[model samples]
Target chain A: MASWAPTVLASDTLIDANAVDYLIVGLYFAVVLGIGLMARRQVSDSVDFFLSGRSLPAWVTGLAFIAANLGAVEIMGMSASGAEFGLPTVHYFWVGAIPAMLFLGVVMMPFYYGSKVRSVPEFMYRRFGTGAHLVNSISFAVAQLLIAGINLYLLGTIIQALLGWPLLVALLVAAVVVLSYITLGGLSAAIYNEVLQFFVIVAALLPLTLIGLDRVGGWGGLTDKITEAAGDNPETAPAAQQLNSWPGNALSGFDSDLLSVVGIVFGLGFVLSFGYWTTNFVEVQRAMATDSISSARKTPIIGAFPKMFVPFITILPGMIAAVLVSEIADTKAGEQVAGGTGGTVTYNDSLLYLMRDLLPNGLLGVAIAGLLAAFMAGMAANISAFNTVFSYDLWQRYAVKDRDDDYYLKIGRLATVGATVIAVGTAYLATNFSNIMDYLQTLFGFFNAPLFATFILGMFWKRMTATAGWVGLVSGTLSAVAVAFLSEDAFGSLSLGVIPVGGQGAAFLAAGAAFVVDIVLSVVVSLVTRPKPVEELKGLVYSETPREDLVDADEASYPWYRRTLPLAGVALAMVVVLNVLF
Target chain B: MPTAPARATQRRHRAGALDIRNIIGGLLAAYGVILTLMGLLGDPETDKTGGVNANLWAGLAMLVVGLVFVAWAVLRPTYVPDGGAEDPSAD
Candidate 1:
């Protein structure tokens, strides 16, 4: 087994910071602390701390909804992917993200917000039973810890490489900052900072892209340079189809047979996307913080608009790095350049290289601040989500039943600290994985894909019994594990006659298979068992629920075209245009 | 009649309505001003991106937008609902 180690940078390669850079970074930290302190006064009870008292507006919740997902891994991994895979990587944003976000806003929000469930696991308890709730709560808690650790690990590694600070020191500073704010102000502070971080990320990335584009000439210039570089080194040439978003022949476009159009559509676009964006509590918590049902329903739609354009800043820089950072024969053993020949390109260091090579001192600080903001936002999001599930779903339900609001609130704060500590420990474990993002997606397949299956059956099919919910969830998760173990690539154990899709593609397929099994088992078991009465299933199930129960009165006043559907239409149109253009 | 405890609770609720937009706007404006100043007055000889000082331009733009958000927050303060939890099943 590979041991955990931090990615280090040579002292000479570190960007020299000036007075202005330090000032910018200092100001950024001060503002974040100020926001946290300000939000501290708002938490008077458990609801206030855990759910922001459900008082945010559409725009605030909307931006934060997307921001929570924009972590260190996202910034670094997506850029690395852009350099490695080219335009095809944009699928993670567009097809893999947009539709699902829209679905959450339009279809699923009514159930979550209308029912007024404090968290996703609470909803599982109401719809399924204690068994399903426990399964989800435990799984979600574990996933959040792992994800938090991954964010911390990536942040520490990046900061160490950029500032030449000890990895442990960097991790400590991040944990202290994140823990202080989250413990003091709770989810409100986390959400407020996430919105702020969104703007900072844009500010940091857009400039690098513009400057790089100017130097390269234009988009055409970037492509030409890449083509030239690939031409010189026949061994490193990207597939002919990599440059285009969607080639005329799907099979010919991808470097591997694993990236089939069918897999991208069914596996990634439907199962993984819906499972994550719709059911995952980390994203849904933002939407649930909205003041009214209408705002809650609009939150993900609002997020989707900005989310559609994020690739320009996030992915474009990597593409530029691919062209500009040339292959150099480095004498140092520890130093790995972005696009080096013979020596491996430290693909994870792509974003750091862009900031160091492109920006001046003052601008460099803003960029570094932006990177810090993303890391903090990501860590805080997981901690908040973890605490909520631990306190409300697990502790309240199992350990300390019938506790007062104050008791629960106290537990929530303590849980935040405890989760943060565990997460810090998990961060050390992250170094074992080769690619953090791929590992994260595989974990999602194990838990969320099956969870979404149960959710779909519960919400849409009223006949789904509580027994079926537990059985489906367990069976679906098992099927996913089976597929992973059976796949020749993932475990290299057994054959299921399934063609070898690469890591990401295989994960997507496993999720798809799990979804199918969940739906089938749920339907069969539910039919055989007794079903709940229509009255009992009122707000929980769609068929029996009244239209007014699902929608806000204010939203009903608007015409059909004036609502979120138009936004979805516009987003879909843009996706089509991008696919064609690329 | 409204009791002393009820009035105190209302006061706490009112105080809790800290407009998050105000915080966002203030922080952006602060950072924007600093970056803008550096872009305008900092070392000109070390022209990294040829001649265009992106820090100054982006900073000014962010400053204007942040100020607009601040102005909006002041002009139309967000209303705080009563301090109470809803019946989860009421809908």
Candidate 2:
């Protein structure tokens, strides 16, 4: 098991900020606050506050959709994985994200937007009655709060690393800043800030990548350096093997413990990626905020363009860090040093060390500010999602029925505050996890893996019954937990002939198992039970539903090349090219 | 469709130059300019990491993109439609 204790790097090597860095960071906060205050007038009702009045343009919503998922851990963790695993890590972007993003936009958006569900859980209630809704809402609320806590924990670590502030002080400062804007502006404010953060992160990290490449004599040089380092250490994997994107070579059979082609294709590409990009409210909420049906449908499609190139910024840094920092060493029992200052580095600190070593004062400040913006955007997405689910799905249905719009709006705002307080408590609890990213993936396995099966059956199959929905969800979650516990010795090995694959691979297998279990149970139970009537299932089930919005004949008369199909075609080709090239 | 006066009122409520996109674009452009200036005239001590002045180039790129967003917002502002009511079934 990885060590849970925080690594203490040499104090002398810590980041030293000049006046310019502080000024830039201060300016960023001021602008974010100003945007929030400016949006206050736009939010006069619950709909406006919760869903941006569903009037956002395509470009804005598109960028925010991807940005909402760009949590601090994604940036740091992907880079860390890059350093540890090498080229195979890029699968998280290409195979794991693009196809699923496209599926959400092209296949699912019509139902989600036309049916007009306020949240994903609301869709559950509409489709399967109260039982499914409660199951989805309660699980989703807890998940969002846990995700918010993770975001806070990461932000605190980054702030403490950069400014020498105490972790508690850092957490409090971030909470105050995020709450100020989010409570004031609501979803609109969060989305606007998310877009801004998208730009900031790209601007900051692109430069870092270019500089690192230049110093290393470009990509070819980087590969050579890593290879040379690996050659010198017999304990490490071969440099050529590390550089290759494919799972195994002639020398070693399916070498990586973290991934295999089978696992990648099924576990991540099909299951986890679809489960996340398709059903997760944090991402879908952004798409749902667009001004029109077409715009909402186009949101994730547009977002996929930038998403295809994100690996260059997020994962390339890890490759650079691997070449710059030393190799992994086990200094004591249950403690492994992955290499940096003080003769040890946790993989999580890879991005931190890169910033310290490469960036100067003015740029360092901008990068730090960008990182902070990412953290806040991530937190704000979860908080806003939590409030929406709580107010619409839980509170409106259960706590206070027949309330005015104003009353619900008040409840929504209060829920945001309450969620933040709960998140703060969870942040303290998160300290026990050995790796934040691993813990998060396990959480996804427990909730979203099965949730996707429920959605697929509910949306496409008209025969799926209400009883089947709740049963599938509960059984799927239990099976996932059981598999995970069995895989680990900590829970005593009850492995049912399934070999343990560590890290992402383990999460993938658990999720894949859950998906299979959920689908089977849903199919069996649904076959035996009475399905909802076809007339009532209109717009919810694809076969029974008529398209709500038809394209203009003038627009339809345009050539095939002018349509969205071409864009999707190009995206598919690019994914193929990337996988082959890498 | 709703009446003209109601539509006009809805449009009026949504109308503003201070749209979130405009605000974000303006802020990014302003910061990009600052970073560009710092890269050009500030201390040359950053060369220890590498000879490339990353701030200047990154700032220039951000400035151009930010201005494009500003232009997009100004030229094609979004207005709320008269019939843009939530689908009652959504609740």
Candidate 3:
């Protein structure tokens, strides 16, 4: 037996997913529900329920934001990508997703909050007026449903693979557990559970990676094994290209070129960053729920450091697993077992295969919890966003403004249950595609990108009329979506051949086209379009600083380095370095 | 009673049409444009028979679009938001 040292594991763990495992998972559920019940009392109004009375500190939102967004799909998808591509695939999350956030927090956040809108759909209201807000609200809610569907399916699939349970039952149960807390508490419950879930998920995974390493024979052994296998037939194995510096599929040339690297930087850095940060109600709600200006700015920025570390703790194992594929198929005592390629049976199938064969029972249980935490956190986050848009954007417009807090919170609960049903359905239906979760995230980018443009032009370009905002949003989104359906086949694996381009390429192309169109149409149309009144613009920029808080405002004034330009320079420098180093 | 202060304010206003953002945007647009342009310029690298011909067509189309953005941002009138109009903090 491989010695269980340097980290934690035991021989029995491979078969040990038992009642205790279920108990711990159940205990976690109870705690989340309890917190929801307690926090429910604090929310007495729609504003309080939806916005936490704008009182949550930045850290709460930050932790929750990362935790929720990190859910089962991200965990499963990244590991899937990691197992398939080896160590380099981390670029999608670390190099691509992380830098995009830094670009967003400094570049996009300032512009987004420059106007005092609460909900993202509300921003559409100010920029496009109420009619367009209705359109955006529906689209935004549907987009949230799309994301939640992916999370639900991923969670169900993980549970079924681990437990041998029915997928339909698993999906329904998963939805109920998440919706219970979200319905009871709203954002507060989701955030509270998230901060806790973050700890639980990490607590399990990091130890597993470390322990799995020694058993697999440390870093040196992993290297030797891979080399020995690949070396046996040097001609058969793919050579490391670009030192794995610019991550790309070994299958495609578009992945290897410096142009792809540039695409990763800009597609992630500008367009997707702006789009997700500004438009995605799921991640953005965390920033919006901050109680004060400092709180709003602080949460997203704090996530930066933690965000950088995840690929190592999560994706790195899958990389090593790629090296051990041929070995896993056979034992020290026995002959070959099942199919294997590049150490993975299938990109999506491999990680579970490793867990079932490689890990001990107790560690299996803990890993199972980590998966649960990821599932719960991710689903809860998406549902929270979905429920918010459904309740705030869609429901409230129909409901009277004067309705009691209880009724609205009740409606929110009802919406949570509805969203849960949709999510469960999504989970079941997700079987339609081979790797649908990864595909969903990239596709969501198409819809969200135009919303980012509206926020930007509204804030900085003062003459950008509300009418212009509507026209730009509609034109940009329709054209982008049209381009999406049109261009998918042409782009294939690495096709930048068509105008719209492929997934990452299209994200930027759509957003860039949207931004350019947004600017031009907004400007040209606004010349004929009516201008926003000065009084409205005043409220939009600076919240009337109460005299009592003058000291706070003065104290909170950020240092020079944190200013947008200088900080952007640092952000850019880091992006360049990451591209070079990775 | 609040009046404009004499302390220096950061230059929040951007004058150039292209900065950190558009550079990223421009690259994507250019990637599209280049594929299209290469087809038209008859460059071997981007040539895709029909694909290059299509990209060439797209490149000209996006070039027109890009030029529209270039013209709009540079020539479009700027407005000072309310505080921006009067508050020195905005200045």
Candidate 4:
């Protein structure tokens, strides 16, 4: 488990599940399929299929909002990060997630919900014109397919690990479960299943956390063990760095403490988090499925409450695995331990090892089912979002025009099937990389960062022109790609190593570069070209839209806790306390 | 045309006919029952989870949460209006 060693799943079969476990997993599948069929009854039109007819309550959408994100990355990747980096990994939540989420709910959702666009790219079309809309649709659609494939591959890998089934069979099993629901009921099915999955995931992880903490004698005992390990191994990071959350050099891969803090705050927190949360249609779609704009505004704020505490279950377990399990401890100390998916163990196996060490059969079944639910929630989000963009933005706008609503609804269902099949092919494409997180971050940097820049600049500065939109997006994406090629290990051995940063730091640098270059180009081009008339920018531009239109008039009549601003304020205060305590 | 009690019943049925609460509540309750039974009859597996009866405790907690969800839905069913498109802000 050397730090620089390749990260791949390639060992012996890891779990020995029994009949009870299989029964629990089967029950979960039945419920999932049942919900899909029930949701199908609600889908009578294209809007129903694509956006749940915009009728779900706030709490449901809120839970689904976070559930859609609690994917393989949030579970396996974060746990692996926890085992590797210790307490510093909490910054990814407190610093990187909550603030941006609040901004999305408070500032951005109204524009999206008010404009009544079916997809994020459609919003782009209304704001910038055909050029940016075309670029955004293609990139977003491709990104979803690639991401869905990653989720599908991880789901398949877990199945193979559990049951010793063939890879292709596991992959098909994973794909079909997700495909069936999304095709049957569309966004409504995905959202409802996500809500169920969110609860199942908590039920599974909370037990693992409590048991692990009890075994390790709670937080104090865990810290002492980490300190002991740090003292024993001089090659690893100091115990102080591991125990504390500030400066996060171990996680950020920066030599200086200041650079790490700045990188985390600006790069990870601002550019990457804001870009992904605000502009990425996968997350936005959940918020967009609310019954009202007020509910939409409340969605991410409600999700933020659970989002902040997730580290307790995900990261703490990884910390426990590092100390409690011998193989993980040895691997952390740079020993070549034998056992895992691959021939050698990696930090990515931390959650599985901990589960195996602690959970008995009945609980083990629930945990396995939870893992499946998480992966399915993630893949369903991607497929649902992909289908919407493909049907409304791509096919309707360009491929075929003025088609009947029923025809587009049929097209949406077909797109779901097509995307899932395409995702199976992309699943193999994802296997080329050693670390899935690195691959995912690079993709986010290339696609999301420049798009955020274009969005923020265009939204505030009405002078930003249509030409500026596409040109800025194109140049920004190219710059990020160029930066990735120049950085160390961003493209594996293909990187030129001129920039020196590797892994997540390279991703940060790329996103930052993309944002700056895009802003500069957009400003330059906007100054030269004519802007869209002020009348046309009513809901699209910030200053032009009325303040009353951005908020719910009935909000003041509700109790303090139910209002958006008060809820957001409470969430903000809680996260600050968590940051200070951790 | 209709009695007051009849009108209330009609309104109740009109709102959230396919309540998500029913689904979530039903599934969690089912899982809770299974785990609780396994805890009572099967081996406690104390050796594995630091001498704690994890399944029994977790199952009971889940049972309570599930019941609360069901009770909440029964007490306060979601009130979606008849017209699905209720975008008041839209011009």
Candidate 5:
């Protein structure tokens, strides 16, 4: 087990920053707060607060969709994965995220947009009744809080590392800044800031990646050095395994290459990815904010273009850090290094160490600002999604049935503040796990995998019943929890070690178990129960909805780029190219 | 009196003034300016980046992209119909 230590790094400060660096970070904060104020002018109602009034353009929502997912967990966790496992880490993006994103855009979005539901749980309520809806809403809210805490934790650590502030002070400051913007303008503030952050993040990381690559010669040089390093350390993965993306045993934590491939494809790619991109309200909310149904359909498809290339800037930097930074290199070589957010250094410090080793002052400021923006974007996405579900899905639906729109809007705002406060507490919970991905992937298995199973089965199979929905969800989640507890080190010391695999492989196993269990229970219970009537299933079920309602009739009149199919086609071809080349 | 299309175009221009592109452009340009100044006058610290002026190049790139966004917002602004239906089910 990786020893858990003091939450804050022992070192005084990781990155040295002068006044100019502070000025740049300050400018970024000013611009972010200014955007929040501007977006406040646009929010007058609950709908505006929750869904950007459903009036944003496709391109804006598309960028926000990717940015919301790009939060600090993605940046830090993926880099950590990259440093620990080599090229195989790209599967999380190219294989795991893109296809599922494209599927959300093309296959499921029509049902969501056409049905005119405010959130995913509302759709569940429509299809399967109150039981499934309540189950989904409560679970989703809890998951968002936990995930938000993870983002908050990373954000605080970055602040602590940069300014040498205590972790608690940094946490409070980060929480307040996020709470301020989200409370002021609601989802509009979050989305607009996300759009800005997307660019800032690119500006920050792109230079770091390029500079790191230059320092290590180039891509070929990186490969050669990695092979040499692997050769020197018998404890590390083979040079071939570190360099190749296929048969990812190191990433999956499986001894057999065949099991690793199966685990990644079925577990991570099919179940977990689909569960997240298709059903998670954080990403779906961005797509739902677009003006027209066609635009909504195109949002994730557009996001897919950038999603495929994210590995280069995110994961490749970790790969570079593993080679270039002496501390990261020593850690990877099975040697202990000191001075990180944890008392002892781990792979999570790869990106920070790289920035310290390279990057001059001006660029360092940009990088710091970028990391802050990413974490805020991540936490804001969680809080905003949590508020929407809390107000519209759980609190308003269950406790107060017939309130005014204004009352619900107030509730949404309160939920945002409440969730943020709760998140600060949860952030401490996140410090136990050194590698955030392990914590996160396990959560996805428990929440998203089973939810995806219930959603997909109910959406396509018209005969699925409401009783089946709630039953399947409860069982699937329990089974996943059981599997995680059984897996080695998945639950820290609580893990029973019955399942031999650990880390991401255990996550994949748990997700697969959840998906299978949910599907089986839903099918069995559905057979014995009475299904919803055909008359009420128009937009909710695939067979009942007319083809005409699923697509925009006017799309053909526009240019090819404006149509959903053509856009999705281009995205698919590009992702295929990325998968093949890398 | 203006033609219908002309009036529509004018309305679009009004919405365009409130476009997010302007904010993105303004901020990027502001950051770009500071970084560019730092690149010119402040310590280059070329040794850290293996003899590259990273700040100058990154700043210039930000400036160019920022201007492009501003130009796009001005040239082909988004068209949001006046008081469009806020409710999705109403359509």
Candidate 6:
């Protein structure tokens, strides 16, 4: 979309490099390596290597969770959004992410950590049967791989932007450095690094704010001047609007509301919140090897708190940049706002400018280190998770002999390397994706959406059979993927049946279709299909299990649905109130 | 019931979830607010070089001072820091 003008505005260029930058960044990296090396001693077995043997204190896991999820997109996207958009765009974090995560922590997490299952698909196998697990494992793994690749790609691009390094070399170095650490240290190393990243990342942002405030007109002045400049000018108002919001003018005519917003929030949130976090292989692996239910359960909730704030770190800056565009251009805010974006200006670049122009030396590097930490943590977490799942679930399931730790660990490392290569390669092809959020959301919707319905039914409804689980999973995934690619022209409209729709409409339609189809087929098949032997059902039923049991036997002690009724009522009220208010 | 990390690890596999001590939500809320306010209010340079605009010299100075308030509010560093789960075995 950009010609690049073959020119680097010194502002867009790497404006400064000094000892202060290196010192903070160097210290942050050293601490991570030190922690990684330290954690290596802890990684003697699969459980310890992958899940920290379920012993992580809540705070470390919490910060690590944030660090893992916080990637290049958050670093650039949030700031870029804040700098470009104004106030309302904060909804991306607050309105969309926060409430959902809170709901997950308060209501949903208890169910997950209580479940005591290692992965999402493992729960499906437990609840439904192996068939559903088989279908979803591949799709879900691919989706995670896509996330890993996209993140790897963003890291490489950021490297290129920061140092003018060749893209592939940067990608490989980052991937290898991180992979080596994770291979040696596993989840403990990842979390330890994440803990360090959390502090350094914040340290970086704090200074950027100071310099930007000091060097510019200060916070209030920046707002008043921009408001004054934009108030009188119609041409500047829209750009001001984009710079201040998520539905940016950068890509012209891109507007969305509840249908879109709900679709996105619940789509990304419920799927990952329930599917990946609760039942999936990668996220839940942390819970699996936890020493006890409290750490397993509490660690994730602790993690959720930071998850809610992460969007704040990056989204606001972009919104602010959008508001201050005219000031940056030495023109009336209106003039800069007038042209209105047509996908020409990459929003990611705007964030980098704010970082270059706004942040001071030491903090900038630390913030950059935060970006590096996120990339490393996310990839490391993904690799650790995927390799374990592949080795334990797939490889071991099919392999002839019981393999040695070295032999299996080697396989896991190879899986990590293979996945990393695929991911870096995938980044080059993300031109089709408009932005990181879009790419992340779209894939999550297609792959994870199916697991949600299947998992819910599998967990609660004892009648659900393996056949039904398989059918439900297949329907959910296939339908979501099919729907993602659909357009108005692809499906003819009907005034009596439906109106013309686009983007996520298809994804929802697919999910709905799958949900209904799964329900019907599961009922029919559960009745006709063979059921698990009664003794095997003992796990789902109570038989001397701990509280973290995914299916509690003492249904009467706390009839979950009955206890959850009040919470659901409150949730419905909030949604209705928000629906009205928004 | 002692609420120490040692007690926490002793019963890590016990009956309840990891309690966040009721303060995390507010911490997150404050974090969101500071970021939003800064984004809305920030405008350091009117010129490309990021020099303080003459008219806003006083306001800009106060804004820098105001950051002290933001720091005071946000950097309080989450009371009940680890939700009382500071166990060596849990690490």
* Model 3 residue A118 lDDT score: 58
- Model 6 residue runs over 4 Å out of place are A1-6, A9-15, A78-117, A209-277, A325-344, A488-521, A539-582, B1-91
**lDDT of residue A214 for candidate 5:** 97
Q: Give a tens-digit lDDT track for model 3, residues A391-436.
A: 7677777555656556767777788888888877776555655454
Per-residue CA lDDT of model 4 for A437-520, tens digit only, reads: 788888999999999999999889998999999999999999999999999978888899999898678888999999999999
Error of 6 at B89 (Å): 14
Q: Higher lDDT: candidate 5 or 6?
A: 5
Best by TM-score: 5
Q: Sort all candidates by lDDT, best to worst.
A: 5, 4, 2, 1, 3, 6
TM-scores for all predictions = 0.90, 0.90, 0.73, 0.95, 0.96, 0.72
Q: Count the backbone clashes (under 3 Å) in each candidate.
A: 0, 1, 11, 6, 0, 46
Docking outcome class, model 3: incorrect
Q: Report the lDDT tens digits of candidate 4 across residue range B1-91.
A: 1121122233345454357776677667777887888788888888889899988988888888878877777787777766454544321
Predictions in order: chain A TM-score:
0.92, 0.92, 0.83, 0.97, 0.98, 0.79
Q: Write the per-residue lDDT of candidate 5 for residues A46-92, one digit (tens) a residue.
A: 88899888888899999999999898667998898888888999999
Report clash pairs, candidate 2: A339-A345
Candidate 6, residues B1-91, lDDT tens digits: the string is: 1111222123223311211211122222322333334334553333432553321332233244434533443444233323322333321
lDDT tens per residue, model 1, A1-582: 121123423432255677787777777787677667767766777777889878788899999999999986568877877766667777777778888898888888999998889999989988887888999999999999999998888877766666667778878878888999899888988998899899888878888889878777788898887677656655542545447655312211234544567677778788988899998999999998888888898899889889988888887888777766442112011244432111245556667766766787777888889988898899999999999999999999999899688898899989988988888899888776655666777778889999999998899998899889888988998998878776644433344636555556667778988999999999999999987776878778999889998888887677764466676677778877776677
Residue-wise lDDT of candidate 2 within A299-349, one digit each (tens)?
A: 888888899899999888878877764332222112466334223555667
Q: Chain B alone: TM-score in each candidate?
A: 0.66, 0.65, 0.43, 0.70, 0.71, 0.26
Please estimate how well model 4 matches the true structure, expressed as its whole-model Cα lDDT: 0.86
The per-model lDDT (C-alpha) reads 0.76, 0.77, 0.57, 0.86, 0.88, 0.52
**Candidate 3 at residue A367, lDDT?**
59
Is candidate 3 or 6 superior in TM-score?
A: 3
| Superposed model 4: Cα runs more than 4 Å off | A1-12, B1-17, B79-91
